[model samples]
Structures are given as structure tokens and as C-alpha cells.
Target chain A: MTTENHPIDQLFKEKLGSLEKNPPAGLMDQISAKVAFRGKIRRMNQVKTAIGIAAAMLLIMMAGWYSMDQTRIAKNQMPLQIPQINTPALAKTNQESLDIKPTVNQIAANQHTIQTTPAKNTSLQSAKPSKSLTVQKNKVVSASVSDGASLLAAQTASKEPSKAAKQEENTVKTKAAEEKTVVKEKSKTESGSNNFQKKNPPLYFADAGVVKQTPSRESGKGNWGITAELSPSVASQSVSGATANTTQQSTVSGGMLASYQVSKRIKVSSGIRFSQMKQDTHTSYTLSQTSGITYLQPVDKAANLAGDVSLYLPAVSSIVYSNGMKTNPTDNFTSDIAQELKYLEVPFQATYKIIDTYLSVGVTGGLSTNFLVGNHAIITQNGINLSNGSTGNVRDILFSSSAGIEVGYGLAKNLIITIEPRIKQYLNSVSSNDQVNYKPTQIGIFTGLTFSFN
Target chain B: MLSVTQLEEIIYKCREENNGAQTALYRLFSSKMYGVCLRYARDSSEAEDILQEGFLRVFTKIRQFEFKGSFEGWMRRIMVNTALEKFRKNDRLYPVEEMSIYEATNWVDETISSITADDLLRIIQELPPRYRMVFNLYAIEGYSHLEIGEMMNISEGTSKSNLSRARIILQKSVAENFGNEKKLVKKVL
Candidate 1:
């Protein structure tokens, strides 16, 4: 049971126990490199986690702002309803009541002469026959009939100037008595009529010079809008300090944006978006095992421009090709590797409108902060995933700037459909590895529907 | 050779992650630790790997050493544990066959004296992974069967069996190689 009594254990221990041999050269350097690399990786992970938390907080804050803005807008809006009246019928009734039979030819001839006087013509021409001049709450029932009597008095004055003054005085006195009677009738019918009459007051006409101006409905339209945009993006990467044969593949990007109209010509927006960059490279690699884990190490490490193309293979006993064929592991093999890098992009953009109309055109430009969210590298032999691993040395954050020309068509009074052709270029390299500089560029046609709110 | 006071100073500096102190400490102990790694590794490359990995653990976890015992002993334990982890990861993928127990052969004292440590190391590296691990843990490191079994994830009975099998193989190899040399020398005389 004891190793001391065992002859074989004793003989081997006595020979090998006190032996010492110098290790191979450069082992210490390798350890130092690994330690520094691991430290960098830890720092990058911390930064990534911080960015993720900040992005979540921004989303929550934006949602809170949107809900509060909706509540405020709902509280500030008031409704006004105007009644429709037939202008010609009221004019005929006023003629019969006054017993004045002025011929149509005579009125037409006097209309030209009335246009020569600037003051009278301005007052007469500015009147809208079908629209109400004033709105009052539950007290304007006979306002339309009074407006008709005043229009008839004006036409009669154009015919006979002396009688016109007396006619207008009589019309005003009669309109005052009718307004008092109508107010008393409305007061009596208030309880009998529906609640709509209390909620939405009626429109009425006042004397020509005493009319109250209604607020323009177009004053604050389209001040704030939310847009959901989707785009099919084409992504490409530019490399410096290294050479790589890579072809970029198309991917999809989309996000929701909230915009505020700061002025008549300028608008600003901010929101979160999802974007990706994918590329395929045909390269040669050798399988190297380290610490019981096998790595598909690229033969030309210098060609690793993006830092996301390294593959770690743990238990690759056999390789299966795309045609469902198996092969033993070799020292070196040529394969197509696809590298995908996805980012959570937060963009701050501003647009300047060139033409604001039913159909609008604008120029847009801004910058975005891109946080890396996904990194994957797959080794495939004719479209088969033989082995999959993650790339290393990717930066946690990247900054990109974009510009575009936007064309939009108004789909409705409060909705517009827009198309933007944009190009985004990264300002810095996506890889943290000092030997390689990999910056990606993206082009997309973004189309979105915007719903406007005051 | 480093004095006790100098070694303590190096440990303090290493705790602060000073690169120079780490190099000094490694220079002081790496030869002895590499000798330890070679006994457990199958080849020189694997021994280098174990050395690198073990030293990294030592430098990163030096703050926890607490100066409770010999710093050298602590580093040796880390090297052994790193080797054991590598064994556990690889043994499942490349399972070794059980070796039959060989009859033990006795060799004269002169023949045993002729065998160098390098020759013995070459012989031990040829043993199966599990047997080699058990033999090193039991014979050189002075671990009991129970402790070896717990570290290697095996039953104590299995550990004893492996140690027995390993001794038989090593005993047979030493006797054959050196016993033939003794026979040649006597024939020439």
C-alpha cells in the first residue's frame, strides 16, 4: 500500500525526483502576451456590459417621454363644430321680407362700380358666404339669418346709396331682437338636446368689423412624429495595414425613430437601430491544438484584418463537407469562412427640408454610436457549417457618420411615406488589434411611414 | 538561488503585478517547476504548455497566496492541478486502453546506477495517460491514493490498480534496457 516499500516506485522516484531541466526559450514571452490579451478582453467585456445597460435606460426614458407627450397633447386640444347653411335660400328670404325686387342685371352692373371703391370692396369681397364668422357657446342659433340680412343690405346699398344706410340700421335692430329670442330658446332646449351641444359649441356670424378670428387648424400640425423604418442594407469593409480577399453580403437593418420639428425647414431625430456586417473570405488555415482545445488557425495570421475571423475548435473529431461527406482532419485546408458582426446602433440625425409641400424633399445627415452585440465566424465547405467559433479583437464600440437625400409623399393630412438613400461610413476601425484596420461601410434605401402629432 | 528575504520581496512585488518581479520569480523557480511539468507531460511541447499555463495562474492568483506556506509549494500544486485539468479534458476524447500487468524483473545495483533521469523520463512518457498520472501523483508528489482518486475523478481502488500496473511496466522497461547493458559489460570483461 505504501510507495516506499514498492521496488518499482522507489527506483523511478530516486532517479527522476531531483532532476531539473531548463524549459524551451520564449515561454515567458508567450505567457506575458496571453496575460495582456486576456486583460484587454476583460476590459472590453466590461465596456460592452455598460453600453448595454445605457442603451436599455435610453429606451425606457424615450418611452416615458413619448407617453407624457401624448397625455399633454390630449389635454390641450379643444374641438369646434360649425353648422352648414344655404346662402342663396337665406338671400331670397331676406328679399321677400324687405319687399325689394332689384333685377339681376342691375346688381351685376353695380358690382363693377362697387369694385372701384377700395374700402367698401375690400370689406364686401373678404366675406366668405358659406363659412361662419364667429363661434359662441350655446348662444348663436339665429346668427346665420342675421348674416344673410346683412349681405342683402350690402347688395341693396350698391343699388341705392341713401336707402342702403337706413336698411342696414333697420337690419341691425331686428337682428339684436332675434338674437335675444334665440338665446332664450337655446337656454330652454339645453336640457332637452344631446350632450354634444354642450361639448362642441356652434359657429355664428357677427357684424362685419366685429368678427372674432378663429385659430388656424394648420398652425401646429406635424410638429412631432414617430417613424418605423426598415431597410435592406449592403455592407462592405475597408482594410488597412493588411490584405484580405473578402466579399461583402447584403443584410437587413431597421429601427423606430422619433423626430421633432425644430423649425419650418429643420427637424432632429434620435432612436435605436439594428444593423449587421457580413462578409465571406476564401482563405487557407491550419488546425492547431492548444490546452486541449483545437483552433482552426489561419496560416496567414497577417490576413486577419477584421479580428472576427478566428475559429476555436474544441472537439472536431471529423469534418463533414457540404455534400454530406466526411474527411479526416488535415494539417492545412482551404475553406470559405463567413464572418458576421452585428451592432446595436443609436443614431442622432437632423434633416433640412428643401421643398415642404404635398410632396417633400430633404437632405439628411448625422452620426451614430454603434455597440457590438453579435460576433460569429463559421467555417463552411460549400455552405455546410463544419465548425463555428467567435472572432476576437473586435472593438466594443464604433462611431459612424451618414448622409442621405430624402424624398417623401404625403399619404394623408397627418401621414407621409418617405424614401431615403443613405450611405454610412465608419470613422474608426472595428478591430482593436493594432496590426489590422477594418472599417465597414453600409448603404441602404430606408423607407418608412411617419404619423404626425401636434 | 534566491534568499528567503529576496524571495519574500519578489512575492510582494508579484502581488502588485510587477512584470519585473514576475520575471525574477519565474527565473528563480521555473527550472524546478519545469522538472515537475516534464514528469506529468507526455512530451516537451506539452510540458511547455503546462508551464506557461501554470505560471499565468500563479501570477494572476498570487494575491491569494497569503504567505501561509512555501510559495514554491503553492506554484507546484498549481502546475499539478493544471496538468490534471488537461488530462480530464483529453482522456475522454482519446481513451487509452488498459495495460496488462507485466512481471517485475530485478536488476543489479550497477545496472540501476547506469540509468539516467532522462532515460527514466523517456520510459515514463511512454506509459498510458491514466497510469502515468497515477504513478506521478503517488510516487513523486507523495499524494495518497484517496487524494489522487479525488483529483482524477476515479475510485480509490482504480487508482491503486493503475499505480500497480504502471510500476510493473516501468520495472520491466528498466530491467530490460539496463539489464542487457550489464550483461554486455560482463561478457566483455
Candidate 2:
């Protein structure tokens, strides 16, 4: 690069043309760590976004399903018809009722059977007058048994010549007993409709050839679940009427849990969850030496010589002999350092529900055992690293107690999503000293998705 | 010395996130990149920072390179851009009117040749950021005034003025170091 042989351009092209100077040590590490950290943060944000979307989708699907269920239940809850055959036997009784939700066709079949039973019985007896009562009873009962004549067959039969008189009495008594049960069921249905107008009434009933079904409350008593939980946590220590602020970190925990429904409103659960905590701590402190040694590190040689008057033409040599490098005063030097610690924790917790419904409000408290996994420390000044080593005498095992309120929503049958804001209090010190007993309390908002195996 | 193929192979491994290859690549090109950074930076530490930042970008955006030109030249451009970015961040546009313009002078051949790379680098560093940028772009990098102006977000006239000011300062420094020269030592590097 020359401009009509301009001396300045000539000087650059000839004397100060190409250069090859090694960069100071440890620069590669800086670049690598920063790049890796950036990539990790990017990946983490993506995962968080994905999880958030999945949770939202689940919520939408659950809401849709719930509304669909409510619509179907409303259609089914319309008033049912009463049997006209035995109106006199309609009586109410005090007994714990069974709730069985059957298909719609089952209710129609019951009403048909009650209306046709008496006429079918009379026709059968008239057709066989001389046959024994046992034979006659068998003949009276139809193949589908829609007449419910099997109950009439169980009555005491008179061998008297007056067959019509005995038959009529037996028929009336059996019809009355059947009507009494129906009236009790009808009263229950009316009371249930008053209590829950939105709910569908039980369709199944006790009868010959109609299968008795158990209630859904019994079916919902599931005892086991697997939950996946994640939380961003911050830990701090209580020290001499002041709290030492620690950096915010995150933990991911999940495990299988077993629960016992001890009563209608209470449940006890225990689970083993694997979790972790990470802290990157930066600190500044004074470091004084007995007889101070000057830290003579390299400085910007170009910047140092820019203003010095006599230093431009220092004693002729390959390098400027004097006043080339600069030094910083270390007489009252302060040190800046970093330390990182990690722990893998196993938590065993119990939960008690207060308001258990479609949305349950619960109080959960538990203890966790923490195991130290990784620790690293590095001390650097400005940008130059001074020292790197290990931390000593740190406790390996620590115990902590955690308690929180968990609000859970049923996404679908046996699938639940919960958000729990919990606080953990460490019982033991992280350091191995009595005086430096740093007990940290951490607060975290945990989100979990649970699937139940009933 | 490593061959071009070897360097390319290291780059390939680096693309695969091989840490050893990344370190090898850094060892291969760091010195040259550091030299470029020094001319653009105010101090040695700032130069290291620029070099580090440039290497990181090289690794992150290595896939963008089509391998159409010299890899060293590509890395040199990144270093220059990194330095320029530092200036952009600080808005380092010193008022041109505030500068005391000195007359350009001639120096001795011995002085021209004898000026240590460090001494020349010092004089360039002492120039105001704008002048330093223009001098590096025009004199060392061989960018035209118009291109320098576009790159630095300044008018062509401002770029020319800054280069002239930088040359004046260097000329004054040389006149102090050693008088005029008849014949210069060739190829000092």
C-alpha cells in the first residue's frame, strides 16, 4: 500500500507491515467457557418454552373434556318415569343408597318389566290349572324375565281348590314389595336432583338379571402416582441478624409416590424425589501479605509509551529496554474470587389435602437429604486469573425441611397438574465449622404433572 | 507449521464441538489475530479481549464461511470488526475540531527502520480513537477513504481528516526519535 512513495506509507509497508505476537495465556479458556455457557442458556430457554406450551395444551384439552362431560350429564339428568302397576307399595326407607351410573337403555328395560309382570303371570296360571304349583311357577316366568315373576315363584303356594284367590294375593304382595323399593329409589333420585341439578342420576338398580355395579367413588381410590417436577430456586443463609444473599439457581425433581386415602377428606403421600442445586458465588475481600510482593503482570506497552517523553527512543535494542511495561500498585490490593457448589438431593415428603375437588388445595411438608456432588473455586483479578483450587472441609451430608401449599387441577381422569410454592430450611451447616455454620433457606416454585395408577 | 488441510480439518472438528480441536485451532491462529487486534486496540489487555471475542465469533459462525478466501484474512476482518464494535459501543467519536493538527515531517532512514514494532504501535495507539481507526484502515488495512467512512459511520472527508491527523502525530514522533533519513532498512519485520 503506497501513495506516490509517501514516506509514512513506505514506513508502514516496509518496517511495520505484518505482525505475529502471541496472545496472553488463558484466553482460549475464556472464549470456550463463554461459548459453552451461551449455548447452554439457549438450550435451557428452548426447553422451558417447550414445557410451557405442553402445559398450556394440556390445560386446554382438560377444559374441553370437562365441558363436554358436563353437557352429557345435563342431558341425562331429566326427570324419569314411574311404574303404574303398584302405586300402593310406594314407600320410603332409610338406608345407605348405592350410586351406579348405567347406560340409558337399562332404565327403559326396567319400566317395561314392571308394567307387563301381572298379566303374564295370570295367563300362565290359567293355561296350566292342574299342574303342580312348582311347574306352574316355572311356566309363568318369561325367558327375558322382564316380568320379575321369579319373586312371585318364591312365595308359599296353597294346595286349596281356590287357585285364583291364592294367586291374586301372592301377586298383590309381591307387587307391593317391588313398588316400595321403587318409591324409595324415586325419593332418592328426587333428593339427589335437588342436591346436584348438574349431575346425572344412577341408572343401575337391584333386580333379577340386572348386574349391580359399584360406585365411582370406590373406583377413584387410586394409591400410586408418578410426578415430574421442576423449579427455579434461590438459597440464602441466616448469619448474625443478617442474611447473606446467594444467587438464584434451578432444580429438576421427579419420582414415584404412594398415597393412602385415609378418609373422605384426608390423604397421606410419601415419595422419593431426586433434585439438585447449583450456586455461582462471586466475592471480594482484602488480601494482605507480611512483606508485600509486587504483582508485575504485563500491561499495554503501546498505551504506556504514548505519553512518556524520553521513553520513545529507549536504549537501542530489539525491545525498548526501559519504561516499556507498566505495573499496578499492589500495596492495598483487594481480591475478587468465584466459587461454585452443587448438590444432588433426595426428598421424602407427605401431602394433606384441605379442599379436595376438581381443584384441590393441599399442604405438603417433608424432609430431604442432600449429598454434595461437585465444587469448584477460582480467583481472578480484573481479567487475569491468579489461582484455582479446591474448597476444603465442606459437609457431605445435609438435611433440610420443606413445606408448601400445592394447588392441583385434574387435567383428565387420573392426570393432575400442580403448582407448589415451597420453602426449604436446611438443618445442618454446609461448612464443617460450628462458628461458620451457614444454614441456608431456599424458596422455589415447583410445577409437576402427575399420572395416577389406580 | 500446519498445512491448510490440517487447519481445515481442525475447523471441521470444531464444528463437531470437539474441544481439543478448538484449542488446537486457537493455538494455530491466535498470535496472528492478536497482532491485528493490537493495532486496533488502545492497550494489550483490550487487544486480548478483542482477540478472545473474535475467536468466539469465529467458532460460533464458522459454518457461515464458505471457505472461498484465505481463512486468515477472514479472521483478521473479525478482529477488526470486534475492535470497531468496541468503539461503536463507547461512541468513541472525538470532536475533530478539538484536535491540534501538527505538520507532517520526514524522518531518517535509520529511524524508520530502527523504530521497534512496539514504538510504532505506541504512536498509533496514542492517536485519538477516530484517527487511530482511520490510520489503521487506510495505512495498514489499505481501505479507501470512502470505504473507511462507510465502515466507521462517518463522512469521507472526516475519514481523510482523521488519517491526516494520525500521520501528523506519527511524523512529529519520528522527528523527535530520529531526524531525517537517506536510506531505510528494508523489510524490518
Candidate 3:
């Protein structure tokens, strides 16, 4: 172009030319490599955390399985000392039989004299029969017939009569002894019922026709035992038109547990559960809202990544189930929690049991809070009408859920090694900011150990 | 004018961690960006500082670029932001109220009509930092007085007044040097 007759524009253009002569030194390589290295470190740290969580979960599961197995074995050995009670009753029965045989023969020899001395012998014989009857009744009390004296007393009435009048007295004594013996036998046959039957009576089975029905319904309240568990979890949130974040949440919960075997394999357990939880949640905000997208001039794109400090409350209560059974290997020992959210976060996870060698996979979800936290720009539509004037408010809260699978190795009678992988997603919106649509989701792998007392 | 595809390629290369691509892109835009930075800086060195920092930020955040408009335009805004940062850090800006457009429409003195472009540029560079910043942003850079006022933390009226003062000073200098170019032209003839 020809120079402008207006010289000021030309001079201004010339000065611009001069200014171009000097350029800043290049430091791009240094800075770029540093930034990249930092990024790599961050990624590495994430991997390390994931691995650690898996290991911890595995440890917890292994411990639980080991403890459960130990409890089972201990339960199996419980009836060891208690069964010996039957031996004493058998010995007493033998002693009573011996004493009765000799006395019975002597009563047979005195039969004729017993008949001739009727009036005089009547009261004496009646008194003796009554005394023996009283003694026999006392011997048949709830106590086991383990005393030799009680059996000897039971044998005395069997002797003393062979003639008609004497035989009648003998019959009365014999009947009483028979009744006492029958009571003792019944009590002895009911050894199984004696233990638990006292605590829970079989009122429904009280019919005499139901003989041989032990009063104690073997409520095999799943061999009362402790359960230790370690489950590896993953939770995350994502933003629309931006990067996704996946976080790992590892937890170990277990304590002294008492289980009553309600059946062969089913048990209801109640105990204190103290849990240690660690969560590494990563959140990403798309810089779309802050970007110069609408500006007439160019601007750099913006994105923000932040980490959260998570805290979990301890849980306590009864664990009701069918047969101390792990319904879904991947999904075991889950607590119910309520939350709100804005994103579609799907988390994938793998978990392992160190002791039982059990492994499983699961998934869960949570929503991003971007719209809820920073600018609150996300406008929500109350699928229902809200009392507030605004159409939709910030959805800072998220709904979190998980589904998973588990694989385990039975290490001991009650111990198992397990691994479970799970995925979690936030179903709620993460941003109240209209400009951002983010949800939190995560995927993780876990390894742990579990113990069952069954 | 580069096609949108070409712009995307450049941006991609820069994001792929290519140093050469970054340097090339910087070279292509440095002149305009330096002009922008100069408007907010006290001197060329300060302007260069802003340019370097701004370019670094541009590369760092290249992934978020959502090609809403011309890529150059977007980058230009970043450089302006960098300049603003420097201005803010140096406390070189002040607040001024908006004046009517008519108040800012004053003309240069006819006495300086004969002055050369180079002489006018020298006068502009010599103005105080604030006046020079207002003049470069509003007049040379084609920024609206409202924008200059916002960028410099001043009212639109103050930006207009500063620009007017800058023009008056430049015109006076031009008048003083008005005869020099004529003498040089006569010598060449």
C-alpha cells in the first residue's frame, strides 16, 4: 500500500515494526516439561492410591474370613464338655438295677410271713412304702440321676413281697419306681432340648403325641460368630463437555458379632461395627463457562481440578440375612445413605479378599456439585413445582449408589480371601450453574479379606 | 486469514506439546499481542514481560479452547488480560468517569497537519503512562472508551478525557517538528 498522506499513521506503523525486533527468550521447553511431569506425578499418585485401597480392602476381608472361620471351628468344638453329662446318668441307672435285683429276691422269700403278720406288718410295710415313694419322687426331680444314693433308694421298693397281700404292697412300690425310672429316661432322652429349650419353649409342640420332639428347636442360630469385612469401592462424578473424574473409596468394617444359627445355613447376626474408611474423590469443572467462548476476541480455555477431604460416619445395627450368606459376592455389607446430585457418574471397581482369595466387581454413582458450589449457574427444573420462585435451584446434593461383583478363596473354616471390583455413579446434577452440567462417577479395583463364623 | 481448520491444527499442535508450533504461533501473533501489552505497560520491556506470561497461560490452557470465534481473536483477549494483570500489579491504572462522545470528538491542531507519522508516534510514546495507555487502548487499538475505562479501572468519561489530552499533547509536539520533514524532503529533492 502507498504511504498515507497522513504521516501519523505511517509513523505509528513504523514504531510497531521497530518494536517487533525484540522478542522474549524461549522458555517453553522448560515449562512444558515441568507441567507434564507434574501431570504424570498426579496420575501416578492416583494409581498408587487405588492400589493401596485395594490392598487394605483385601486385608480387611481376609481378617473377617479368618475370624469367621475360627468362630465356626470354635462352635463345632463347643458341645465337647457338655456331652459328658449323659455318662453319669447311665452309671446311676446301672447301680439302681443292681440294688433292685438283690432286694427283689429277698422280698420274695419273706412273702409268706408278710401275709401272716398282716395287722402288725401292715402299718410298718405301709410306712416303708410311703417313705420309699417319697424318696423316689424326690430322686426324679429335674436333676440328672447321677447320684448312686438316689438309684439305691429307687431299687429298695422293688423287693419285699411275693405272697398276695405282700405282693400288692410290692406292686405299688414297683409302679412308683417304674414311674420314676420313666421320668429319668424321658429327661435323659431330652438332653438336646435341655440347653436351649429352657430359653425358648416349644409351646406349639406341647402335645403329648409329639414325643421325641426335642424342646430345643436346633435354631442353629448361625454358629454365633464374628464377621470381618473389607470392601473396595469406587465413586465418581463427571461434567458435560468436560473431563470425567473417578475416585476410589476403600472401607474396612468389622467387630465382635454374635450370630444365632436360625437354620443350617441361615443366621441373623448383631454386633458393633467399627469401620475405617478412606476416600480419594477427584472433581473436575469444565472451564466452558469462564472461557471466552462468547467474547469477540480470543481467550484461553479454562478447566479446574480439585480434590475433596471426605469423612464417613460409623455405622451400627443388626445384619439380617439368610444363612450368613453373601448374596452377591461383589455386593456385601453395604450401608444405606441419602444424597443429591447432577451428573451421571459410573464407577467401575475390582475388589479382592486377601484371606479367602475372594474377588468381585461392582459399580456405583454420584453427581458433580459444580453447579451447586462455585457459581451456582446451573438452573434446575423442578420436575415438580417448587415453593420457591426460581424454576430450579442448585442441585448440590447427589444420589450415590453402587453395584459390584466379588471373587473369593476359602482360606480357612471361616476365613476367605476375596476381591471385589465396583462401579459407582452420581445420579444427581453436580452444578447449579446453568453453564455447567457435571456428574460424578468412579471406577476402582479392590482386594480384601473376609471372615465368617458359619 | 487462516481457515478454521488451520487454526484448529495450530491449536492442536500447541496442545500436543510441540515447542516449534508454539514458537511459530507466538511469532505470528507477537506483534499484535505486543501492541496490546504496550497499551497497558509503562515501556516495551514491561510489555514484553506481559506478552511472555500471557503466551505461557495460552499454551497451558489451550485444551479448553472451544472455537466459538476466530482463534486469533480469542488469543488477543488473553494477551489483553495479561496486560491487564501487569497494569493491576504495577498500579498504573486509575478510575475516571464517562464523558459524552461529543466531548471526545475534538480535532488535532491544523498547525501540526504537516507533521510526519514518525514524529506523531514519538509524541504519543512520550505521554505519561496513564494517558498513553488510554490513548493506545482507545484510539490505536480501536477499543471503545467503555472498554478502555473497564480495562484501566476508570470511568468512560475519564478515558475520553485522557485520550483527548494525549491527542492535544501529541499535536503540540507535531507542530514543533512540523518544519523538520519539509527540510528533509527539500534536501532529498
Name the lDDT value of residue B174 in candidate 2.
62
Model 1 pairs whose backbones collide: none
TM-score of chain A of 2: 0.40
The per-model lDDT (C-alpha) reads 0.65, 0.55, 0.41
Per-candidate DockQ vs. reference? 0.37, 0.33, 0.04
| Candidate 3 residue-wise lDDT, A1-454, digit = tens | 1222224333444444334333455544444565567567667657655654565455544665645654694334222111122454444443443343322222222111111123323432333321222121211111122123322333453444446646655664585578557757766778757877788853321000000000022213334443333333345434334332323344332333333444442333343322221222223211111121110100111111122111110110111121222222122222211122222221221122122212212221222222232210110111210001111233544554544454444343344333446454545544344454544455544343334443
lDDT by residue (tens digit), candidate 2, A245-291: 23434433333344555454445555544444444333323222222
Clash totals for all models, in order? 0, 4, 156
Question: TM-scores of all models?
Answer: 0.40, 0.40, 0.32
In candidate 2, stretches whose alpha carbon ends up further than 4 angstroms from where it belongs are: A1-10, A13-17, A59-454, B92-104, B179-189
Q: How would the candidate models be sorted by lDDT, starting from the highest?
A: 1, 2, 3
By DockQ, is 1 or 2 better? Answer: 1
For candidate 1, write residues B120-183 as lDDT tens digits.
9999988888999999999988899999989999999999988877886786677677755322
lDDT of 1 by residue, A1-454 (tens): 2455677778778988866899888888888888788777667657655653454344444444544653574333211112233666645543332222111112221121111122332233233221111212321111122233334444544433345444544454465456546655766686556566577754321101000000112114247777766677897666643455778888667677777777776777878787888778877777654543446555565465566355443334444322234444465767777777888888898887787775678889999999999887766654434444667778989999999998876554445567789999999988786665777789998766565675
